[model samples]
Target: MSETIHTGGCQCGAVRFKAHGDEFASSICHCRMCQKQTGGYFGAFATFADNKVEWSRGEVSYFVSSNIAKRGFCKDCGTPLTYEWHGDGVSLAIGAFDDPDKVAPNKQLATKSRIQSFDTLHKLKVREDTYGVEQSCVKLQNFQHPDHDTTTWPKE
Candidate 1:
């Protein structure tokens, strides 16, 4: 079973939050919309049930980015926080967590439009000792499963 986990905030610490519930699947979305939203090649997300999340410090500003998903960010710092699907539940931005090491991106979604730079990003190796021992050294690329797709995503 998965246990409750917590984390949040922006670079300056103006916004904060506490998320609860099991650590669900993490994913890297390479869709153009996600790229524009994050200003990066893609966005990293850690999924969770809606009821499992709570805002302990600041209110989040939500934008309906798509017909099926709503993106959330910190009102104070414009920190991209979450991409919640109307039917698929919430997927928190991995960077919002206090320790992003706890989550691992499992799959590359919307690979059809993935940028060439994304290849370089993937080549960057994650050094285990770089972050610390308490946090595991597992890389998103290294994670594997027999039933990969079925286990990592929620059914809409």
Candidate 2:
């Protein structure tokens, strides 16, 4: 049987990766370190064996966040890509995936650090009415990399 292939990259398309085979875990980490790395309430990730991942495009820069772990990211765009623990497999940020929905978080880690507001986040009202104003007043062109592999980026 053929193994599943999952692709993803940073915001600027400077780095890309492909993960083969099934993931070991999908989780949302609410630890302080995770929040700092993602600049968000939590860090969602999908864990895979180290050998199963391949850097298909540019290289990834890493920061040794702590004595036990390091974080991988794109130096060009500062996008968080991976969380790797010493002697352990790597976990890729869920949002960095081409189809983030495919790797939904199945569990939550560091629950004690979870933000209080997260409990009521779903109660917030949607602001769909702003779409008209945004479209009319702003000339927005998306510079973000598309959610799939590209032959060459930035259209030189």
Candidate 3:
């Protein structure tokens, strides 16, 4: 992969981070722990050197998911941040990244007990956007941080 700098954080912008290296590997995992952490069918991640990443804003709380692994997440908003394995190195949450569209999972892991309906999820029905819904939803302020760097976050 080409060299790049990746930045992102929790939904409330309480915890921001930046990784200064390209991903060594990107994968989707279907383990139960991953499912619980992400609240999704699977968790997508990009592995990077742990030393190359830094928390720019706030710190994450680490949960010892196993003897050899730990999960990091935002303490304020409960946003999953990182999953680190002793032997496998650091894995950054793909969904938590600023430009999630650019982070693609090239491999899959821990698929023995994968969610059965996950493959067909895209085939499921979705509500089409109605005319006034977007306008109405936007009338209230969006407290979530924008998908870009900011000098300060969550303005008081």
Q: Give the Å shift of residue 4 in candidate 2.
A: 0.7
Query: Which has the greatest TM-score?
Result: 2
Tens-place lDDT digits, model 3, residues 6-79: 88898999999887776468899999999998999888998778777888998989999999899999999998
For 1-156, candidate 2 gives per-residue lDDT tens digits of 998888999999999999888756899999999999999999999998899889999999999999999999999999999999977588999999998888788999999999999889999998876758777658777788999999999767
Evaluated at residue 103, the lDDT of candidate 3 is: 73
Top model by lDDT, which number? 2
Range of the 10 consecutive residues with the lowest summed lDDT in candidate 2: 128-137
lDDT of 1 by residue, 25-105 (tens): 889999988998899889998887777777665577888998888888877668888888867567888887877877768
TM-score of each: 0.71, 0.94, 0.90
Model 1 spans > 4 angstroms off = 121-156
Overall lDDT per candidate, in order of appearance: 0.73, 0.92, 0.87
TM-score-based ranking: 2, 3, 1
What TM value does model 2 have? Answer: 0.94
Give the total clashing residue pairs for model 2: 0
**Which parts of model 2 have CA positions greater than 4 angstroms off?**
131-138
